[model samples]
Target: MPEASFSRGAHHPPTATASTAAASTAAAARGPDGPGAGLLGSLAPLLAEWLPRQRWFAGKGRPVTGFALVSATEILPSPPGGTTPGLLHLLIRAQQPEPPGHRHGFGCGHRRGAAASDCYQILLGVRTTLPPSLAPALIGRPSGGPLDGRTVYEALADPRLASILLERLRVPGRLDPLRFVREPSSAIPSILPPRLMTAEQSNSSVVYGDTFILKLFRRVSPGTNPDLELPLALARTGCTRVPAPAAWFEAAPPPEGPGPRPEPFTLGVLQPYLAGSTDGWQLALDALAVRADFTDAAHALGHATAEVHLAMADALPVSVLRRPQIEHLAAAMSERLDSAAAAVPALQPYRGALHAAYEDVAALGRTGRTWAAQRIHGDLHLGQALLTAERQWSLIDFEGEPSRPLAERRRPQPPVRDIAGMLRSFDYAAAVGGHDTPQDWAGGMRAAYCAGYAEASGTDPRDEPELLRAHETDKAVYEVLYEARHRPDWLPVPMTAIRRLAAAVR
Candidate 1:
């Protein structure tokens, strides 16, 4: 999914009084057999069956053994009149039954019997009758219990409810555990129609009349989300290459075992929407289709990337990767390479060379030459970039790779890692455009990008050849596994890179 893409719209009368009463009634029936049983106990079986079917669910191959409710709140009560459509915001913990010895590839960190669970954010629209427009988003009707015979569907798919959500965000207030906080300088209008962006894989978005876009994160983790954090930091550094954050919503997780404390988990973010902007992925494909020289665009994108990196370095904490940290990074890459080789048979042939690429980086670290590290766009690709109508590049999606742990994604890393990601994206475009056999166009674009980065940041990525090669190789290994699992037809794209890199190593 393009990082900046995807959202829903209407205004209901002031129904706070009616909503409060409805909320009270719903809360009162939260037992095993009451009208709210579906919200508590009965929703698990339904979610277990439904979640696996979602494209965003990461635990597709694993069986969901049980569900633990992290928190549940009635964000909106049944609208005025006799119509009963309540919007409920939920944070659910899905328990996965562990296989004896399974290790997921691409640094997913999935291990047997190790907290085998994932947290998901679900916005459910509950109603007695299914609307024809919303029938596609239907989760399923409960067989029995509090919500028996009632339909529950993804609420973000409903434009009316999505507009209501926008109004709620426009007014800064706390809804118990859920708090809507707006940027102090934001000037968003109160009534903009909303439209759902349907191309997203890991999140739901609502675009508000081309004014702002709200992204509701699907899988959530504790602490401030980097998607919000990084953009805010970049804005503070006076970086116009990223859209400024307008508003965000977060909820305090319910207390856990003894002495539970309140820690906020970011649920969604609102940012100024760039209407008519084209994503870099599509832009590259278009350029490739016509065999247009993409060197200028690639160079401009590199400058934008370097600008963001410089801004991040100025706004966030920076560190030097000493021997131990460098070794650890190399080790992690080696581990991912091993896991990818095990998962993709095509990668096995190149494992030795890939292992050597990681070793070369480790050997460089042993030479006592420390590299600068700072927060970066950890999972940068063409899809994460946007070219505005002004023909300028803008970066998005600082949440990093979804598979890695939040702490790991937030950790400082060499900027070349991002540079390597973009280079790989260029290769992907070339391959998909039928130019992989001669890769000269992609190679020229890559060199131009590095030149632009050096011109902007005063540090040529090519100066660190070993580190760059290793990072690129690591990213390709990850692609091999990802494509093998999710997109088997695209497996050859990364396999080409693997073969070329292996030949170079030999």
Candidate 2:
């Protein structure tokens, strides 16, 4: 598979002419009841080979068994002149075998873990011939079916088609199953140039004239995505700690599906871009490179996080995790540890010690202790936080961990989970920055961050050492498995944390 390209092609005449007979043929091939109706039948052969190689594809190491097209829309018709490519928006479900020992059920009224089927939002550019510039975005030519002999490539790679998406979001309306929603009174420019963000992310992002950034979720699930849901909630509370959604889009689930019908699936969200802002991950690394004290920045970030949490609590429902809930949380962590240890042998030696951490949580629950639970930035880390030039911290990407089931990602949880995730991130920065005494630097920053959080929220995470430790342990266990699978060279970074966490447990 070619590397995902961000190259842009010059704009051409958006209008073209084609014979009526030819147009009918193209429509028939792409139409649902057309002779070449089963689009996936032709595309599956190519997608099965190409999808797994993508950086955003979640089901790595699993073979794609098959694909089914949930919906397809011809955003643009193929021009007989062939000066520009036609755009096709597709929501295709890729089916794969369930991983061994996978047991998490989709609590959102869907069957899961029996078989792995993920719906992906794809934009394909169809043309009679491919351009040299778009060679990298090519998905390959279909040998049969309606798209037979036509070149299919990633559409977002083309600037002309990328602009069409923004045009859709500029107006609030529905195109059959796909809905384009614009926030009331939100004015979007008509001709902002779109350029694909070249970052390797779980989803694709396009920056429009440095004015707005639209995140297109690659792997989609039914129901409101927390990335949009949380920010919208915070926006209601007048919170400046998160960027509000300017516009967004989603797909209405089919009314009569084979299994459970789910809520609308959020496909993309557009938010005002914070120009001249840097992400916290790069900011930390830059600080580390110069041996600069990052305690001040970390403190500010913690304060920002507390503010967001407070706003979230104010805008959304909050609950208390009693003994049963606490016990369940501990059990879930233990199960993850077991799964991770089985996948990564390096975790085995520390298994007993790590298990002790979760047990402590259960013990506290057994003593009738309770903790506050609310919706939070599920996958909080340095990378997810953005720092403006004015030193203000704005949190982004509330979609949580992509690898987890959608139900799990959306579930309410203790804010300490976010705190723990940030704490682990400091360790990652220390390790990657090559600091002589990485732990000392990370430890001090962590203390400062907690101090700031305490000052803002009127509660110190350190006061509940057991709860904090357990979450941190769970995070490190997750990191170990992730690194082992994706980046073997980075395994030691998390392994060191695991060793420290395990030793602390003992």
Candidate 3:
């Protein structure tokens, strides 16, 4: 997962809704060695303020210094004295001052220089005058720059422009650096009214009627994103537990970059939309509202997860985490705990206990134990699962944690990492649902989920107590840090898990 990646918080639908570092149109005409640039100009100041404010912007802790154009394409350039809005697709690299005492390599695709920079995907809607309906999506009127005297807002917020995105997917071709590709067997219906999806935290999604959903990666890097890669792999296995991508788009990497020529960056994916499907998070909450049993759903989800995991193992590369790899894994987890604790003081007291859990893994490795590793859903939670009209479980959003590097997300890992995330999600549902005995509900669901996994895979996750506990601890620590930074109100949810896990070690 690049810092800019997709997160499936909810599928609720219309909302509202580039690259080049600094090369000019003249430079492009001359065929300069650089990718492309110079689209933002005076708009840089406005973007400095506006970029960090977006939910998908990952550089939250630091102030934006400036922006450089990586690439720019005028989907519909603004015409002189015209009322019709213009759409500009841009990839801009946002520069931010490095935090004091921050070590390098925290996340992938970050440019380290005078300032740390992260590239973002932006769609700008340019209009001569603002419409009342589009006001909420306004980025701000640039006082000067290329977009002078014009109102610019999020392009995806406008249904007409969003439909343009779908049309691009419908007919696959190259838009210079960007390329749209579709499955040979798939045909996307033209002119499906596009509606913006709300509640996504990391990426933007647009639904084309009820037929397809397109997720646009907000923060971008140069590589094939697992959200597109993994589902395609599952599709090859004939797995219906995950929605296969119908059409997708990507950007070719800049040719001038150092090191190996990087793979093209996955920009967006289009997949079959499961209309009327309830996400597992909402379903669990609804069940708790009525004091209904969710263990049945949990069990079914676990089985579905097993099926996908098995398929992924068969379809993608698998490896064994020998003593050295296992030791390195535990060390990495411990390092994350240390870094997270420093930023979140609430985690300080639990550090000792959590470290002990990681040590348990290291100890097991010292005894020459090994664990099997395979390509599994890097990030799995209740929100990532859906219950269809048929009441069957289908997993979505294989992008993994957005803060990780693309390479790490694509790497094979123990399947329990995903199981732990789902278990934590069940606890979150119980807490958010305000169940009287939240622990009791969550506990039963956890047990039932594991039982179902055992039934399908012939192995219970609980059978490896130390390994399971370590992974769960890792997930909880990550949750605590995420909640602390993004949603303070949700802090206590992971804190509860931290307390229990710490106490258990005691």
lDDT of 1 by residue, 153-261 (tens): 9999888789878988899899877899999889989889899998888777889999999999888877788999999999988999999999999988655435555
Report the C-alpha lDDT of model 2 over 24-115, residue by residue, as the tens digit.
22233345455335355567777878888888998888877655556677778786447778998887666667667677554422245344
Candidate 1, TM-score vs. the true structure? Answer: 0.90
After superposing candidate 3 on the true structure, give the runs of residues whose Cα lies further than 4 Å from its correct spot. Answer: 1-38, 106-113, 142-146, 257-259
Cα lDDT of candidate 2 equals 0.83
* Tens digit of per-residue lDDT, candidate 3, span 176-240: 77899999989888879888988899999998998899999998887889999999999989999
- Residue 380: error of model 1 in Å? 0.6
TM-score of 3: 0.90
Off by over 4 Å in 2: 1-36, 104-114, 257-261
**Per-prediction backbone clash count:** 10, 0, 14
TM-scores of the models, in the order given? 0.90, 0.91, 0.90
